[model samples]
Target: MSLDVDIGHASGRGPRDLNEDFAGAVRAQPGDRRQGLIAAVADGVSGGGLGLEAAQTTVMGLLSDYFATPPGWEPTVALDRLIRAQNAWLADHNRRRRGEGAALTTLTALALQGQTWTLAHVGDTRAWLLRQGEQGPELSLLTQDHALDHPDQRSRLTRAVGLDDGLRVDFAQGEAQVGDTLVLTSDGVHGVLRPTRLAELAAWGTADLAARALVQAALEAGGQDNASALVLRVQGLDPRQLHDEQAWGRTLPVPSPLRVGEALDGLTVTARVADTGVHLLYQVRAADGALGALKTLHPSRASDPQERDMLAHEAWLGRRLTEAEVPGVVRVWPRPAHASAFYLLFDWHQGRTLEQLMAGPGGPPRVADALTAALAWTRTLARLHRLGMVHRDLKPGNLHLGDDGQWRLLDLGVALSGQENAEQRALHAGTPSYMNPEQWEEGGQADAGSDLFALGVTLYQWLTGRLPFGELEPYPRGRHRREPVPASRLRPDVPIWLDRVLAKALAPQARQRFETAEELLLALERGASRPLQPARALPLLQRDPRAALQLALGLSLALNAVLLLWLALWR
Candidate 1:
């Protein structure tokens, strides 16, 4: 579908001597719909050596260089690469000058292609989405502020372009609906103006007027630094082309059940594998005698739009992930002209689920085996995170341990993209016992960090055969302070370093946890060189009840002997 955008931007130096804020929008080439539109806003750090130049370069360079990117690259990937390159140049320039302070700036960019809007953000700059709701207007904050959340440290930024050699830019993608309005602003404007006030101003008149009014409101509210705002209005989209632009989850349909020994669409069902009430899995043989697993929704849920969408998107993601580390889908079986069902074909792996393997007569894997599995899963997750995907449901039940000594990640049904919308975020995608604290919150968003938390929980279970946090009756949200008993305390075989790694991964706060899978893997590889003190004293009774009982008996006998000797001496 074609995108029609109306854009406006305004920037003011406010009380500062020089305006360190820069904002701009680039329109797509005439009739070249693929190029789409680019709009960005950047704010230079106040004390930087080249604050003004940094701001200008970030905005102008992004708008110009984004279009120069390779034509076939996805907007999210293209923008991220461009931003990193620009950041490197800025950092290099500062290093050459060997200045007292480096050039630094906050950037938030939006690229609208077809009916999708992709965002790339760093620093404290913000992006917001405003749309008409049934009752009134609805506003969704699209970007999380990179500044400290604590009140006393709110003014300081934790991340920014050119502040370091490597940049970690946040990227998200969502569908853009007609009549939707997107607003991007620097901290100076957003910090002073409330979201409700900004929403009111944005809905008042034309985009330019709205943008200018937002900036003015910030100024009136005691704007203490450079303030800037960029507004974009989606005017229209082609109706016929809308289907092609639908969200990944919304594009697939559910199919009817398959019968064993039945040949349909060139694949013959050999046997049933699993039949959860909601979904069905079957072992199938292709015409050429190749084995595959076919997965689809249960017939009962065929009419359920949400279930069907999730199943369809699972297949979509399975196909999109081409990395060797990730289990690849063999092919999506085409809907037969006579049949009215959709199904996905995945390479048949002869293996048992991690849960099954752990539950075998052999019990949980040894410490070394557990560590190897953890490392393998971490690397797999790193690849997934790099692809902007989060395996929301990461548990032993969803992992396959092949007889060939390899791990395969299973079940993308509940996984989500980093840029998923609010509705998708609300879906129940994770196991309660393994879920991170944030995943339990209302409207909690899952990201790479959440996945890492799940990994920690899984690894802990593998090592100690129990969950870190005791299973809760009713899933808990908000703050939970209960710390898991250290792994070493439960299983003496577990190394202190491994226990420490699990503790960090399962930290109650998302920020306190390992930031990336790679980071966690590195820690695991470097085992604790020295012994780690236990988090709490495990009473001798708990450590070895037999030894404790033996010692208790000996002490009682000795006390009785001493009492007899004293009695005899007194007589």
Candidate 2:
């Protein structure tokens, strides 16, 4: 059900006057599966009088800061950021006290999350993996020492924390399985004990007993240095999270198109919904007669790896949002154990999209209702932006109004959560009509500003049933020199204050627009009592480059013609 592990650590002074080795392990809070487990070992360089301080700080800093990073960040990204920051701080401290010995240490850290293990290492500190194989228990070294190859200089570290301004950390990742054992040690333990002897001790018993035995054996083997050992045995692995989506999509088979009355994985298809060329949607009924929405790739694009990855990412985002209890989003169901095909199952809500409501026989909702909905939606966007997520596609069609009177944001296939590969970010996503002007330019990428722009466009359409920029195609278009006709102009009932807010939201230049969702929300909350000041006008050139260019050409042409006429008269 969740990541399960047994961990223990031990350190002894051995023949040293003071123990300079530090080791620590921190497990994620119960039910916090995403944070996973972090364990580290640091061996303080003996020459440095502050060796104990360096070892303790490096190990403790990593244990605390790694969890503080954004949950959406990849393990490698988070570790690199924290390690680099710690290294910089320690290096600066050493520079300030130049005469004093530098606080230098060797660090080797490991993170076990879901079904994978990630390692970050430097100096001669080591990590090892012991696994039960068909042949027997095997021990494999997981990290290389950042030291010299020559026998004489083997103990001299080439890379270490606080050694210099620059730090080079080696990183490695591999699949983790139940019954696997991980071990971390300071050079004092591994330098004196042979691999075979270490492996025998590591396989002895409980993690705590095994770790103590390792330190004892190293000291008895005539090791004169401080000895430390940290051990962890995997008891179980958590369900694969977002990082594993690409691998899952690659291995799983894409199901053939299903028809009404057909059942796959206990869900019977009741009706085909929409086929958007890249994907297919279906209305299905569970065994208990509950309705659900199923989404899968269209048969034509079944072989496209990018499409599969995109779908998996969408599913992962949906699940993560739901688990976080993020409001205004649909909940995604876990994949069934007997799944014959790769598809996403979401809780079905009976609702009409904002687009449908705008086009219905009754026409768009009242101005007050639309404004209220916009306020609620903006709050949702604020939460998403705070989490470093951007809903690439935010339009009326993706905004749902449930029969239960709640609003939901849908279709996260193109959203960016920072884990997206460059290829995914470059894809031209979202409706052309709702997309901002910058997104139409070359090399443009979507961000929170883009989502806010789309929201403004959606609200504009909801109120007036018209696009502010007329019908914008995917290619180059006429420059928009003038501002959007105020919403009040299209609908007399729309208030001036609401129009002002929308104008700020729809500013063509990102600098002139509301940089955050919270700012837009505050404006809406103020309403007529505190109307926002009008935005400053842009220079003529920036207002409309096309128009400026045209005017220059026309003036030049007329001046040439006048000169020619004068010359002819003079002749």
Candidate 3:
């Protein structure tokens, strides 16, 4: 497997855009004289004073150490170590030059190991997983934000590279099926682009073309932050039956006692099998055989108190969505009274995930369809907003693709709905890329406007296949500087009306845009004032798979040739 990557940046109205990004695979060994790929991204923080330093710190560390392999090649661990080193380096440099505090910034990185992916990250950077079978996005938000001073200050980040210490990170392992696309980015892309648009960009064409589509969408949306994206399709996976050393996921043998089409309690366990090492995900059939999903916590995690809460929380929230009259959600159990293990039962989404359906070429859906989907998603969010709930972890994984082509939100394990504004003060929750500018800068609150901004970004991705700002730009390590170009510049095909809608949603001044999903819906219904501009179909932005394969082979052989040449000379 190969890693796909992209980066985009803009000098908005502020001092400058500080977003940074990296993609592709990187691995190094002392003995193996081979080259794969080295990718990195750095976003300088605005307002903090030294944005550029932060960006350089991250990229330089990756470039210097990317190929050097130690005992641990786990992508997440590798990335964390690199970021930590970068911060330490930055601190020393800052003290020598200007003295006092160090610069601030964020970094994101990913490497491909054969068919598997290794990842590392710091700050509000993000990694998305789009898979087959599952609908919407099979995203695993890979990084935890270190912002927010208090529970009411949901926007404030408490951790980041170049900060004092304690860099918050979220990490995990996952499967990448053929045609599955992984989109990585800094806060820029999601801040400006929408998920639907992201899926369209990744799937509407080749990975490369789709990547550009996303960037263009961000530009049109008035990129206030640096934006970039790396869209790569999974062409292969470790077909070798997964091993503990390879991937750490829940595993189980097919259970024979509870065969498919068997009734167990009010819900029937159908097609029972192991999904990962920690849990068993079963296709559930109602008394009438109407399908649903019952995921019993893996026997292993059954012992972890944290995992237990997550399982129970997910079930409770799934049921609540049902109570709220949401579609794409089903909860047969009011609570998990009989759950032998931490478990959750949800309606089994039959259609492909947004990430899955989004694969393939354009001739893709019309912008109107994208807009419709965006509106529907926002409406659902509004329901939560009314309930004073927040999806602290609103990445693609929790989303499902329904048979109706609608984007169904799922996984309420971390959903914030404890009390009125309780989510606002909660410290450091939410996917980084989806967060608003203010949230990261100040220990601010998560308001409807911030959620609206996230919704806007998701829509932007579906329509344009890009984020508002490219991850290539450095994330801010200093203070807020200038704003970015208009999203129209990136993808002229986007309706001006839609652009306006995005612009309003992505406004840096959250108070300026639509305050609620309903308000945004009204605006979307109006559509762009200008007609769609004609443009040539975009080419895939991610490098061609065959091309990448050839490159990998060529590099490996060249390294071998060099070693042979040196040995002969020595002899």
Candidate 4:
């Protein structure tokens, strides 16, 4: 199927002297495979004298600037950059005016491509969706008003394009299917017509007819401000993008091994970094002399489909996490169409891994630095977990301390998403020392709890320079019979509260451990004032039934003797 859509927009002055509502859309031709369709609406602040100018420039700028962005950038990333620039420009103009009317507007924009639709919104211009369902045509509100919730103060906007130096645009993405109709409206139209009325009118005819009808209806309903409507009726959907790593891997050819100074697809290998058994990593330079890390299957594994698929999965996940705006993770670049081989390009990070940092000339990191890094790293994990992913391996070597003073998580080669198959979940994939007890059991699967347990071990090592469970080896499992030595016991300066937090995180039983990264992060963030207690041991009955039964009989006989003595004394 081909990407196709019918788009229309209408604007009217209504009862206002001048129209301050502007809307526009751009549909890329068939040759523009990735650009898809971009649509936006902006409604200028009513009190501002340059309202019309503000609305017009904002819409025009978005329509033109959006397509100029690099094709590799995700729709959300591109929109964020463009809108922030627009906000800065508008804010500067307002600042220079020196008491003249401010140039501020509400913006709502959409980008649809390859069966996915992304929305970027600020202020009160609303987005609505109409979809045909088994029952009937269903309408849904796709945006929340950035205004006060109070009825009397509803007109006051809490956020707008040029309201301040800082801009916070709301972003959302979802599947866009054929027969879906997206509707955009300014306050003038929505405030006058209820959602029910709007949806009913939007469902009547072609995009053009529906758009004009909505604007006219708003005007007829005594709308006091300019009314505007933009509609996009999906005529067809493009083939779904291949998100499966295995499928993507089979479509590309792996490149032959390269020596330093060799170039492939505009990237020159500057140095061989590491041979990771299954994959090879090299420090490469682009045409512009910017450094990047290139990862591909090793020469021996070039023909191995499983190895290729794993590398592809890593690249896909890295890009996905980076696009999500999660900090402290390495970013993977999109594969260029001209590329002749399958390889992942990552933004080169200049820093040592945590393992190196620990063993460096400076020695172990300072307590304060460790605490700061832990908090930031926990946040990164929380973001990953929220996206339904688990980092199967987490250790000092996989955690990097960049020169930019950021703690980045590395290597998604064995990371598991919620959608992973049973076979994928059963794969034993992590440093033995860092793997939680649950992961060692039969049919054990790594999950959020396991990741947190690994984080706890990493922190414990960072603080005390020793593994909590000692250096565990792969194979037949050996259970830890005693609680791990606390961080405070090994490192005198390690806080008692932190020790307790780590203890809870490292609990052998999954149910006894912190269930989520956010929970552990909160405990760390609160620190001393709200210290967490160490995980309590399981009850004797649960731990050992025979021991509990013997203890119960001993207590019963002692209680009987005491009762006989007391009765004799009373008599």
Candidate 5:
């Protein structure tokens, strides 16, 4: 792999685009042992202050290390060092400007060493891959982003190259193909353009032209922020690399002339998960001999190169997330590409999915599981949201209760970028029952808040044993109204304070919802320890740091309630 970079930036409506993008692709030195890397980036930050300086300094510091020691660099270690270096440099730079404080900017960087490349990012910047398509072209998101809203934090940039003294870098490596085009950009580029249009642009022109074109299109489409992009093509020698790259995206051998009873490894077909999507849930035991489920594509159907590639990619992503120790998630197991089929092997969890529990027979009248499940549900959602990956489909069916007493969130089959991305409209992958009104009213993509809203629905169902707006049928005309039933009605013992919190989380407007699951968790955690009042919960949602801190001790709630009672008696 070689290197190339082109930068495009302009002033925002505020007169300056604090956002600055820096791109660098350094060819490996003669003594270098690994394949060279192709790196590119675009970073946009609020306040326009030193956001540009922070971004520029990061790439400069990273490029220096990258070119200095390409001879012995592993993707994981290199990326971590790069992020640490960037964070340290930024911290020093901020201390110097203590009078002005720190300026925040999102970072997305790509380093390709040989046929393999790793991506590291924080905040709204993004990375994506595009390969040749049978219908022309298709692209997949490589980095899920480190934004305020997912795997579910809301304060923003839980990890970034320059957000704080420490940088929490999200990293991954994948095989790059001959014609594979990798793209990195600040939130502004895809934030304004649609995904199909972005893919079309990348497919139609050279890496340089396509990247610039996408940026230009975004600006034309009323892009309100500074924008940038780095686009690169994989070339040069390595026949073996081509095979490896081709194999990365295929897993399960699609059944062909081969007999059905013939086993691949050890999985036996038990049933199908989704017929159209080629998702097969197989019965098997993991290498550790633990009972597990295996999901793979049908071999005959996997014959379609593009579909097989996608399934393989999905499996790869699944495994990566799982290994990261990011809680409440499942990851794909890595197996060599074979038979042009893709499959994901999972540790069969003993307990049923939350969805199964929701509709199970209890003779109809609803009983509340909200209190029992609230902590795990909110905490689990909070952890993932902090990592910047939304579960998109977050109904009861997708949440699993493991026999080990740990709650597991499964099936990120439709995860998408929350930052600016062209494919925002293409995120039509959620169970309608749990989907928020934004899905039908605006065709809006899922965000951390959106996931939280769905979670509120799940929490409600678990508590009330009823759907939010009556039962949602199939996708034809799935309806979600603003009228959410009070948690008290279904489970009358439910505290008024807790009900208020749920109502805010499921607020119809995104802004009104608890900014992060952490916020809701904090309230819930505090409320769980004390008897909070309903009248006080709304203000609690709006309170400053000190009031919330005081409330957390369980002291303020009682005092405030007594004061209210006194005033009511006086009146």
Candidate 6:
């Protein structure tokens, strides 16, 4: 599929003696559909002697190297690797000229792959998304400010390329619609313009006019530094490109079961690890004797388009996720021209599942271990949420504690991406015990909030060795509501703050839960000192009529006794 875009950029020295801001956009060769488009903006640290050079080199290097990356590499991975190399080069160049200040700059890059947008950010420069809303076009900030929070030091960036020997960059990707507009700006521009005003400027005339107007707006608002703006208006996206792979997957027929000694596609099946009715998993050895996991749909689901599509979607997401804690796909075997079933191979992780580890000889994890796991999973979930995907089935069983002491989230069979259709939402996927209340209702869709609720349940179980809401009934029938008991009640070692956090996460109403995984993670890190407010609950009278009636009768009797005493005293 083709993605047509209208691009524009403008930069001005403003009040600065020399402009240190740079921006550029590059389109892939006309025949190279896979490389897609790249746009970047960089702002040099003004005090650095080589500020201008740093900004120019960063933007130019990124635009050039990103397109030169191998076609097979994902946009985020490619961009990150290129940026790191550029950072090292800049650092080396600065070291040679130690007499002068080191070259340092903030970089933000966006890559449009089909209808997906991948972002790499490492400084105060900002990226924003403007989408058509019911009221009007809405503006949403897409990058963190990456600067010190104190008022006097707010302009000082905490992270930037060439500033340090090693760099930690923020990477995110999400689906983009045809009408969406991606905007990138140096702090000189955004620092002076409010988000509302930026939205207005973004909508003016064409992309070129919009970019020029934004820079002018900044200059008019007392710009004190170099100002720059880059605007990309998504003119069109081909829907078929997004789903063609899935359509091909639906045509593959399920293969028959394999025996331990049988070989399929150069891999010898060694053992069957799991048979979950819907799918089958096998431990296999490649011809070279390397170990791997083979996953394929069950014969029963061979003709089912929905099942096939889910499998394809899972494979697609697995390939895109770059987090170490996310299980990586080793290779996806093509459906041979003659073969019926399709299978996916994954790097075999030789570690116990989190479920097994917790239930193993060690018993429930210590508070420290539980907290660590919670934080790790929270970060992983946050990444997934930012990518506009929800891991509907998040539980101990789907998590693997690698022998290397790393925990990786596994399985995406029921995961939902931003592009899912209504039919997929009504499919009733996910474990009921870990699902939020909304997931039980007809046509209820799971979002980041639902994922947080599942995380709370998972953490509760990990800490207390008990389910917060007890056993769950099957879907369409599991509508019962019950208050979650405090984890401290079962495990005295569980802290009150931790329990409160879980309680809020398990709140029956979606609105009562943490808005995002990042918030939940922050709360966990802060510990009991910052206690979460207890979730609102129904009054005792509404909760239990019998207890309310008993209390009312007791109060009435006491009132009658008091009246009689008063009357006798008066006589």
Tens-place lDDT per residue, model 2, 1-571, is 7788899888989988899999999988765535589999999985645988889999999998887777766677778888888899999998998687788899999988777788999899999999998889999999998899999998788999988888888988876889999999998899999999999999989999999999999999999999999999999888777756654565577878899999999999999999988899999999999899999999899899789879988988888888888899888887786577889999899989988888889986798898889988998899889877999999988999999998999999999988776678889988888888888778988999999999998999888989888877786475445689999988999988988898998876888899899999999999999999888878768988878998999999999999999999999
TM-score for each candidate, following the candidate numbering: 0.51, 0.65, 0.42, 0.56, 0.49, 0.52
Candidate 5 residue-wise lDDT, 306-380, digit = tens: 555445435544554666666666544555333244455766667777777666785332333455477777887
- Better lDDT candidate (2, 5): 2
Against the true structure, what is every candidate's RMSD? Answer: 18.6, 8.8, 29.0, 19.9, 20.6, 21.8
**lDDT, candidate 2, at 448:** 95
Candidate 5 global CA lDDT score:
0.63
The candidate that wins on lDDT is 2
lDDT of 1 by residue, 392-444 (tens): 98888888877677787888888886433345557877788777877666667
Least accurate 10 contiguous residues by lDDT in model 5 = 6-15
How well does candidate 5 score on lDDT at residue 513?
Answer: 75
Model 1 clashing residue pairs (backbone): 255-341
Candidate 4 lDDT, 1-571, residue by residue in tens = 7778999889999877778888999877556535588999999985645877788898899888887776645577789999999999999998998888788899999988766788899999999989998888899888999999999998789999888999999987766878999999999999999988998999878899999999999999998988999999999986544233344465567778889999999999999999877888999999898899999888788788657756766776787787787898988776665567778899998989989988888866688888899998899999999998999899999999889978899998899875443445567999998888777767777888888999999988988889898998885354443469888888889888988888888875677788889899999889999998656788877644666888999999999999999999999
Candidate 2 has what TM-score? 0.65
lDDT of each residue in 1-571, candidate 6, tens digit only: 4678999999999977888888999988876645468999999885644887898999899888777776545566688899999999988888898677778999999988765787899989999999998988999999998899898997788998898879999987666778898999999899999999999999888999999999999999998988999999999874423243354465455679888988887788999999988899999988788888888888888788777777877766665663324432123433334344577667787888778987888988898899998888888888888778898999888887788877788888888876554466567888888888777666677788888988899889888888887878767342325567788998999888898888888875676679988899899999977887766786767555567888999999999999999999999
Better candidate by lDDT, 3 or 4? 4
**Model 6 — which ten-residue stretch has the worst lDDT?**
327-336
lDDT of each: 0.77, 0.87, 0.57, 0.84, 0.63, 0.81
Could you tell which candidate, 2 or 4, scores higher by TM-score?
A: 2
Tell how far residue 338 is off in model 1, in angstroms: 10
lDDT of candidate 5 at residue 430, scale 0 to 100: 82
